[model samples]
Target: MERIDRRLGLLFALPVSAILAGAFLAPLLVVAIFSTMPQKVFDFLHWPDFSSYRVILEQGYWRSILWSLGLAFTATALLLVICWPLAYGMARVFGRFTLVLTVLVVMSLFVSENIRLFGWFLTLMKGGLIEGHLRAWFGQGFEGLLFNVPAILFGLVYVYLPFMLFPLAQGIAMVPDDARAAAFDLGASRWQVFTQIELPLAAPGIMVGSLLTFVLSAGAIAEAKLLGGRAVIVIADDIETAFTFAQNWPLGSALSMVLIAVVGTLVILGLRRVDLDAIMGRRR
Candidate 1:
């Protein structure tokens, strides 16, 4: 019976495995092949070389890579700091209100991303809602809110907050109420209970959320384009320019491979420290 169940599970997983190979791995393989090929060459008669990678090693290109990494890291860190307390509240303190909060978060996902960003654009624009209100009340308003680095960061945080929040809430929710009560009964302060118990138990979710936020933020082109204007140049923007405007597929593929490698390494490292079963509330 157990053998039959195991075979059935494997059979069920075959479709997903095939889909991943075709949809994900196939594209990556194509990108890898193209990354090694000479740029501006569409012919089959071409030699694989490191020229594309050498282009990426240039000072200007390297700066874009650093910029993307820095933005992703900063945004992920901020999300963790902001979401931790919010998730804890949703999991423990809010009780019936948690449902309302969850619905709000999920609703954001249903709205178009571009529409949400456009709303932010209007809010921050000169003579828009924020400036209008400020000018009306304070007789002065700042007009430098849009088309800047801070605007891009704000948009990114707003868009990705829910991704971090849900996993963190789930992790915190899995912490046993009895364990918390026992800690309190043993004269442990609330701070001590949270610091020593809750935080440690929620580490897996924190890692997952951080990885997701970092990966998404790093690859973001739309937010940078809309909010950053010409002041910011991220790796994703560079990749898009390379492929589209510059007409350099090899260079674009090289940049994409580098991003894929970095994100993949982070995910592997995070997974090493996180227990999937624990995070999913599943028994082995």
Candidate 2:
């Protein structure tokens, strides 16, 4: 009976597992194989010379990678600071407004990201929405805020705001009210309570949110391209160029493998420290 049940469970799991493997694992496998091929070659007949991997450094792709990592780190840090108070309020203090705020944030997701970004592009452009209105009404105007590093960062923050906010609120919600009350009863200051009780208890969510925002921002090309005016060519942009215009699939695959390794290592190291039971609200 136990064997039959095990077999039945495997049968049920097989289809989804196969689908996931085909959709995800297969692509990574292909990239891994291609990464070893010589540059500009398409077939698998050649020896695995790892020439493309060397090309990453030879062609100065490392700079793009560094830029990507730096921007992703900055964006993630900013999101943490910006979202913490709001997430705390939503999880602990907003009351009726919580639903209102959640709805507003989620509404933004339904609109296409490119459309929203293009909206910002129009609004920030010189003599555009905000500037144009001010110039008309108040006779004051400013240069376009688009096509700069700050604009790129702003776009990153704006696009990924909900990603950071929701996870953080979920994390803060896991902190029991009794804990905060007890801390206060024991004469803990607000700062002390936050640092000692709230922050630690809510850490799992914070980590997840940070990881998510970092990964998304790291791979983001659209924000830099559309908003940044190609001032910074990110790793993703380089990969895209390699695959599309450059028509160098092996180099693109090599870049991809490196990115996957770095991000995957970070994720593995992060998940190792997170307590699943705590995040899931399990007693154990």
Candidate 3:
């Protein structure tokens, strides 16, 4: 019976594994191969090398790479500030109210990012809802505020906030009420309980949330392209330009390879503190 069950499990997993390879790993391998070749030699039969990476590092590409990193890190930091308390509030409360609120938050994630950005565009432009309110309250000096970095930041936060909240809610929910009671019973102040007990316990969730938010925001081209216009250029946009307009597949592939390397390094560092295997529930 055990052997049959094992065979059945492998059978079910085979298609999924094949799909993942074709969809993800195969493309990545192709990209890696292309990144090492010259643009003229598009043939996969050619040998690969590091010439593409040399060009990437020795050009103006670094600026866009830095900008993408900055934007992603900033958005992730802002998300932690905004979503932690919101997640805590949702998790702390009981009843249908929490259910309704959770549904709303999840619904925001359902809306396409482009649609959300367009909605914000109308809201934040001059003579729009936000502008009208600002003019009425803070006066007319608030002009030219929405079409730049602020808009990009807002879009990023709005899109990725749910990713931050869900993990945090899970972490906070895992904190037993009895544990809180025991901490309080041991003469721990509210702040102490939160800082020393609650936050420490929830660290893994926060780390995961930050990682997701940062990576998504880093690779985000639509938000920056639409909201930021040409005022701000991100690495992903640069890659798109290389692939589409510049027709420089090797350079674009190289940039993507660099991004993959950076993200992999960060994930390795993050996994040091958090039990990644446990977090991913792979323990037998």
Each prediction's TM-score against the native? 0.91, 0.95, 0.88
Error of 1 at 161 (Å): 0.7
Off by over 4 Å in 2: 137-141
> 1-284, model 3: which lDDT tens digit per residue?
99999999999999999999999999999888889887645667767766778887788788888889999999999999998888888778755677888899888878888998878877777777787887888877456446588788888998888899888876776677888889999999999999988888778778888888988998998888777775688999998988888887888899999988887788778868885554454443
Candidate 2 at 243: error in angstroms?
Answer: 0.5
Off by over 4 Å in 3: 1-10, 45-49, 132-142, 276-284
lDDT of 2 at 174: 92
Quantify how close model 1 is to the true structure by its C-alpha RMSD in Å.
2.5
Each candidate: RMSD: 2.5, 1.4, 2.9
Task: State the weakest 10-residue window (summed lDDT) of model 1.
Answer: 37-46
Best by lDDT: 2
| Full ranking by TM-score | 2, 1, 3
Task: Looking at model 2, report the run of 10 residues with the lowest lDDT sum.
Answer: 275-284
Q: After the best TM-score superposition of candidate 1, give how far the Cα of residue 126 lies from its true spot, in angstroms.
A: 1.4
Q: Please give the CA lDDT of all the candidate structures.
A: 0.87, 0.92, 0.83
lDDT of 2 by residue, 1-284 (tens): 99999999999999999999999999889999999999898878899999987888898899999989999999999999999999999998999999999999999999999999999999998988888998999987888788898899999999999999998999999988999999999999999999999999899999989999999999999999999989898999999999999998999999999988888888889888788777777866
